[model samples]
Target chain A: MTDRLEAQFAFLNEADRLKSVLRATTLCDASRPENSGEHSWHLALYALVLADQAGPGVNIDRVIRMLLLHDLVEIDVGDVPIHSQNGTAHGSAETQAAEARAAERIFGLLPGDLRDDLRALWEEFEAAETPDAVFAKSLDRVQPVMQNLACGGGTWATYDVTFDQLESRVGVKIARGAPRLWDWVRCKVRPWFG
Target chain B: MTDRLEAQFAFLNEADRLKSVLRATTLCDASRPENSGEHSWHLALYALVLADQAGPGVNIDRVIRMLLLHDLVEIDVGDVPIHSQNGTAHGSAETQAAEARAAERIFGLLPGDLRDDLRALWEEFEAAETPDAVFAKSLDRVQPVMQNLACGGGTWATYDVTFDQLESRVGVKIARGAPRLWDWVRCKVRPWFG
Candidate 1:
């Protein structure tokens, strides 16, 4: 029992590094770029506030869990912005390989059952195939777009993001599980890009 | 549908204020005092990482949801640290009233259903009655103790906290739902206090 508790604490202590792992998107207040830890929290709040718009059969409870766990890998690889490297690294095989290894090393800090449970959730999120994972991914994409829109094209202007890129990279994934939210984002995004 | 989506976005945008709401506890690295946003995120992560310690009948999914929503009232009332104001405001009647009003206004930013759903989760956390709420509240108290332990008595040194105060104010609550965690904390905390 002591060993189990110590292992759990070790995993959590490692997670603290997430606070120092900054993301590219600026806060809505435009104060500073948000850290991965807070961004994941905001995304969980998005899961709660916007669960109504999730794809049918999405278990919002599970969706919320996925959002909280999804970004833990960024603690190891740092964030690869969707537009960086022409967004190639965003889903490249190499990046995926690095993240999978990070998952093992980090989640491996816990005892067997927990490591498996958390790693499985992380894997499910990466797959983005289940209804819950689909909705989780949709929110993951939509949040940055909303943050950009709020701060007057926050990262969009930073990356000189174009409408075509937004459509191909962000819009389609969000539309997969949350058509209504995607529609709203599209209307808001058009003015900024135009 | 458009109106509902807009309302959700408005609530989310308003929630951006949380990142600015600072708390007394510093980050584990002692870089700066942690803000309520990331603190809540850390607590949610704690819920995920330490779930094995939860009390019987504790539904960890709801516990995670409750933790995410718990401190949001801080966005309105600001954080009343457990050691501040003789710790009176931590759960004082006036504080409860202020937090209740804050809950209505903040959670109210969402449309009716989402608003009610989130507000109830927040209330469950405040009441701390059910097994899930009990475990959630245990984590809510334990995190700061762990943080203080990590950073060489982060807040305890600030407030000149005493062992009796730690026992009365913090330890009992954690033990209620997670006795094992309290046992672990007691050991680590003893060396500092002694």
Candidate 2:
């Protein structure tokens, strides 16, 4: 019992480091760069509040779970802003590899059953195959774009993220999850890169 | 179409403010004050990761929803800290009333159906009724105590919180949600207040 309790605490304590993993985009109010912890919370809220925007047969509860766990790996790999100078996901191949390893060490803090369950969920989001994953991935992409536009082109300006670049990176996944929102966002952000 | 998008954007923008509403508790890392947004995220993770601690038949999904939306009202009423100077919930009747009104206005930012759904969830948590709310409230009580212990009495030391006071306030609720955890935590934190 003592051993098991200690294991859970270890994971929760490690989660504190997430608040320090800064992203590229600033808060919409432009205070400072939002951390992964806060970003996940906002994304979960989007999952709840924007359930209507999701396609038919999408399971909102499952989508919320994916969003909550998605960027947790950022705690270990660290976050590379969507529009970093490199403009890559979690930085690059090296960081991606780091994230994969971090996912193990971090989620491994759980008991065996939970570790397996969460690792599968994390992989599900990465594959973006299921309806839930598609929706969660779309919300993940949607948040930074909103932050950029709300901050008057936050990361977009910093990274020189052009429309073509933006569309290629986020367009397909965003369309898959919520086509109408993807279309509307395109019109809203067209001038940022131009 | 624009109207719906506008409503969502407005709500999302408002949520950014939650990141600024810092709580009395420090991160287990003892870095800076943890903001309500990040704290809520941590709590949701607790809901998912610690669901086993909850009693049988408790809906983990519903509990997670309750945790996610719980502190959002603090954007309006602001946080009073579980172990604040007064060592009370929101400090005063006036403050509690303010939080109630805040819950309505904050959750009301969603489109009609979502607004009602979320407002109800927020209220359910406050009432602490049903299996889900009881389980959610338990996780809520559990996090801060763990934070204080991990930080070697972070906020507990500053506030000079005594064991009796802590027990009187949070003991029963914590026991109700996860009895084994509560029992372990009591032994873990007894030294802090003693």
Candidate 3:
């Protein structure tokens, strides 16, 4: 019993390293440099709050699971911002490959059934198929927008984000998944543009 | 335009700081050292995957919203673990007061309507009176169990958890909110005790 307890502690110690990795990643909302963990939380919220806004018959639970585990790979691969077109152009493939390896190791700490369940959820999220994945992706895009708006143009100005670019990257997702929120964004941005 | 952008960025910056605070305070698995951000993310997933398991007629979206914002206050008050009862005994009132202040300053970054909308969500989560809160709290408890089980008894062994204590903490909530998962947990733990 004592040995089992010690082994569990050792696994948790390793999981702590993953937290550090996530803390290093930043999001589109520069005001709130998101750790990977926080990003998961926000995405989960998106799955819930916007579940109704998704297409009819979408499964909210699957979307939530995807959001939570999608970035677990980031623990090893390191975070690559979805918007950083250039960031991915270089060593992203290698980074992602490494991340997959790490994810397997980290998740393997769990009992077998759970390990499979989480790994499957992670894959489902990456595939972004079915209603759940689509909704999860939509939330991923929207969370940063809230951060950006809250932070007063956050990375937009720092990164020299043009109106068109912002719309293309973030607006398009909102339009599809949560039209009401997207409409709200359009109204909000009009005055700024003028 | 520049002024509005500046204001927005300022808010994002504060939000970023809050994320940092949360990351520092909470453990990932309750037993493992997880950042508050990750904890939030995990709970969000719990809401999603466990949506069908939630009480009938409960709005999954609202539950998700509650889970996401539930810990935003931790940005100000810092995370107080469920088991760290002593850390919170004297500090909760002070923490609650501080969190309210932080929520105002942080959520205030967005335009009035958005700010109010988010602030209200956070408030509802704190109150935990509605179906959303009950289910949200259930998810909050469940995620740590999944993490602990994944990490091989995580804090359970570290805290010297007895089977009864663990069951009491998790069983009631799961039984009420997610009977199927609770049943699964019972099955999983039976062998451990034997």
Candidate 4:
């Protein structure tokens, strides 16, 4: 038991490797940038507090799980911002391959049941057909918007972003997942545009 | 506008510094391991999934918020493992002082309403009087146990922990926040003890 415990600790110790990879990939305020761990944590909280606001009857727990594990694959494939016009092309295959490797290495540290459960949750999130996935993606999109607003147009300024681009990035998810939040964003951005 | 944006970006960027401080303080499993970001994210998800199991009338949103922000102060005072023999010896004055500093630095970044809201949530969580705080703490305590069980006695083996120690650390919160979960733990751990 002690020897097995030691072996497990070695893997847990490398958990920071996930953080390191996240830090390398994500941008903090769209401009300044942040690590993946912070992004994951913040999104998890969003999934929790705002779950009720999700399209009715969404399973928030599953959404939270999805949010936490979603970017973890970035540990290998690296973060590819959904809004990156130029960077989006041809990245999915490589990213998918990287994520598969990351899921195996990271989730493998846990006992069998947990490994399977978490890995399945990660896969479910990627598929994004269920209520949980939709809500999780909504949280993911909203988090960056909140950061951008708080940071005074973080990515908007950095990318010379137009209202059209912002709308396109966030509109669909917000409309589908949390219309109230979408309304809030629309109201909030209108003043800036004017 | 640029000046305001830069200021906000600086605030968001400081999240890295906070992450570093939390990494230094909290244990990943039990024996002073894993980064703080992981702990925060894990607990948030735990709160989300277990919301249905919380004592009757518990506000799931508030509980989730508390779980997310409770440890942000670890950014300043660092993680004080409740199970540690040293925990009882630590004075509240040190923790309070650190919390004050952390609250100011971290929450000050957001615009007015958000800053106040998050800061208040953090303080409320620390006070632990509200139902949200109680359930939040329960989830916090339970997450490590789940992780340990998954990783085959994570901190229990590393620290040579006893059943008594585990109970002393987690008992009260479990009793108040989620009695059923406590019962489940007892059932699982009883065999290990034998």
Alpha-carbon runs more than 4 Å astray in model 3: A1-18, A22-32, A85-99, A187-194, B1-35, B42-194
In model 1 chain B, where is the ten-residue run with the lowest total lDDT? Answer: B51-60
Ranking by DockQ: 2, 1, 3, 4
Candidate 1 collision pairs: none
Output the worst ten-in-a-row residue range by lDDT, candidate 4 chain A: A23-32
Candidate closest to the true structure, highest DockQ: 2
Off by over 4 Å in 4: A1-11, A22-32, A85-91, A190-194, B1-23, B26-39, B42-67, B73-194
What tens digits encode model 3's per-residue C-alpha lDDT throughout B37-89? 66665566555445556787688767766666677666667776544542244
Interface quality of candidate 3 as DockQ: 0.24
What's the TM-score of chain A alone for every prediction? 0.98, 0.92, 0.76, 0.82
Off by over 4 Å in 1: none
TM-score of chain B of each: 0.97, 0.94, 0.77, 0.81
Off by over 4 Å in 2: A85-92, B89-91
Q: Candidate 3 at residue B97, lDDT?
A: 84
Q: Which residue pairs in candidate 2 collide? A: none
Superior by lDDT: candidate 1 or candidate 2: 1
lDDT of 3 by residue, A46-151 (tens): 5544455678867876677677677766666777654465224323676657867977887776545556777787767666676677677777776666666654
Can you write out model 1's per-residue Cα lDDT over B104-125, one digit (the tens) per residue?
8998888898888889888878
Q: What are the lDDT figures for the candidates, one per model?
A: 0.88, 0.85, 0.62, 0.64
lDDT of 4 by residue, A1-194 (tens): 33333333344444434455533223433443566766788677556445446777787766766776777666666777665653363247876787789889877875555568768988887776788787787777776776666556665665666777678767677767777777766766656545
Q: State the DockQ of every prediction.
A: 0.75, 0.76, 0.24, 0.18
Query: TM-score for all predictions?
Result: 0.97, 0.95, 0.58, 0.60
Task: State residue A172's C-alpha deviation in candidate 3, in Å.
Answer: 3.3
Candidate 1 residue-wise lDDT, A1-194, digit = tens: 88988898888878877888888898997889989888999999999888778767889888888888888888889998899877787889989998998999999999999899989998999998899999999999999998988888888888888999999999999999998788888998898887
